[model samples]
Target: MEKEGLQRSVEFFKHHNINIKTLVTDRHVQIKKWVRENMEDTTHAFDVWHVAKGMKKKLFALSKEKDCSDVSPWIKSMVNHMYWTAASSANLNEDLILAKWQSISNHIINIHDGHSTLFPSCQHDDLEGRERHKKWLKPGSKVYEKLQDIVNSRQMKKDIPMLSSGQQTSELEGFHSVVNHFAPKMIGFSFHGMLSR
Candidate 1:
């Protein structure tokens, strides 16, 4: 669906009073616009992993102009830090820290700022919200508990395995597998195709 269709869907959800606490999406202008216009109360968050990937892409692009490879890792680490900070709270201090880090390359930093602006306003005490999220986890708390159990089981396997050379990289490995399965065949595909059903 296009922007208009997304807007319509959001309107319908709003009309029906859907309990959409947060809308997670990539940085798409249409989705950003629709969320701004219709879902003022809903929390809007761009996916952290996507933001990091974008930063990495831009860093690679900038490497031609200025040898950014030396500082690229630092910049990426800082970018990830910014995501955690922004995800935690909307305080000006965190924003300022992010701004300062991006100021390495003014142009690149500006792009980062543009990405940050797409999200809804965050509050200083937003970290409290993360704690509250635990109470509302999907499939109930039991599911999360079971997940923890499975993780513990995997750790046990690692310790007791008859032969082991490398550490388990299940989460990261699984992430790449899923990305390969679902990401577009080429770059610049429509956001709807990339994300929506």
Candidate 2:
């Protein structure tokens, strides 16, 4: 299905003289390779949410580690942090994205200042208030190590810049859901039904 979709899309674009320079999509390994092999002129980017979800799964697994339950509580916040880092670093490259992500580690540790290469201190102004309600991970703890492993993963490092943009398939998914209402998947449709869809 992906191959057919790509083929039709390529044909449609060629027929309409649309010169696509880049395409952003979820992290499907097959599609990634296909795009690279077939669309050499186009740059491929993985959607940030997909990447963050993947990271979340990995982190969740790591949180089950012995004495590392502390990492589990931070998973959601870390995923949100990934999204924020991506959205805020659109004009920047992978290095800046990684640096910004690393800053979150500093933020979690209450060492908001003098920790990030990109920022002199934590960007949040309500640090004191947040600190009052939160328990920070101690340095060299098992949970901290697991969190570091995720942030520094090779896949995360490679895809930071791609994820740093707003492109996503969320709206596409919504559209598909609406289409399903028009053309219910459990039943077959006639020519009119197909045409209406």
Candidate 3:
């Protein structure tokens, strides 16, 4: 189905009393526009990792113009911070972002589209002694961290069995074997032809 169709489905689901608090999706312009227009009440979050990856790619491309290896590592670290800031309920304070921005020689800050709502509560004004912004911890910080830890641990455990085995098998080899056995050939194709049929 098309974007509009998917959005209609989402609206239909909501109308039917489906409990969808937030919609996590990639940074598609159409989807963003649709959500902004139709689903104002529902929280929308762009995939943090996808955003970071895009930033990294752009940074790498820009690095070609400016001869600097050090900047690449810094860009990577900043991208990682974006992911962590998004994933963690920990607020990404404006001061913290400004600090990182100031540290970089290039104007990487300008590239930010400002679509992400998942940011630190503390604004630029909050840094001043005058404004009294509440310093309450984010609601789901601990839970988010715990969930990430669990996923990482599970992935590590899954990899352990693969690490123990010395014999390595390529997926390409398996694919080729299946294709050769299944495809009908002109010569000596008795069992293979039957299998294909």
Candidate 4:
């Protein structure tokens, strides 16, 4: 349905002589393939919110594991890193974005130097003790290993670069939220009423 909707919308726009240059969407494999094979002119990017949402869920699960409770403290920071990588990356260059995302593995363990040639070290000022960096995760430990695994997963390598850099679908999402609030699916409304909303 997503692919079909995208195709129909793209077709509709093309019929009206509107060419889409960049499309920000969740990481949908079929859409990726269709956009690649069908719409050569359009650039497809995955929204950072969806990417971070999945990362957060995985981290939360990892934190629940025995001996990995230490990871709980860094969950928010890890998620923020995803957002930061998307927002900070210029032109959504895949290599630079991937380099920045990979840096988190070292940063979480307080091993910041030599992260990457592209992003050699952490960019922010040194963390103020309590207000900034949390208790750092230990290196060569189970938590660190699991986190590194999650951070550098095969899927992450593909998805990190696909993250949208700016002008995401948040406004559309907000409009949907407002529609749900005013005209929830459970309640039926007349055509005029729904149209007004």
Best by TM-score: 4
Tens digits of per-residue lDDT for model 2 on 1-197?
87778779988998999988778888777888888888899878777878888988888888788988777667888888888887787668667778887787777776878865666566776655644567788889878877877787787777776773667778877998998988988989998977788
TM-score of 2: 0.83
Error of 1 at 190 (Å): 21
Candidate 4: TM-score? 0.89
The candidate 4 region of ten consecutive residues with least summed lDDT is 125-134
Q: Residue 71's C-alpha lDDT in candidate 3?
A: 39
Q: In model 4, which runs have C-alpha deviations exceeding 4 angstroms?
A: 131-133, 186-197
Question: How high is the CA lDDT of each candidate model?
Answer: 0.45, 0.78, 0.45, 0.87
TM per candidate comes to 0.41, 0.83, 0.44, 0.89
* Regions of model 3 farther than 4 Å from truth: 90-197
Off by over 4 Å in 1: 2-16, 90-197
lDDT of 3: 0.45
Tens digit per residue, CA lDDT, model 3, 110-183 = 22234234422322332334212312222245432332232234432332111211112244446757776656
Clashing pairs in 2: none
The Cα error of candidate 1 at residue 36, in Å, is: 1.5
Best by lDDT: 4
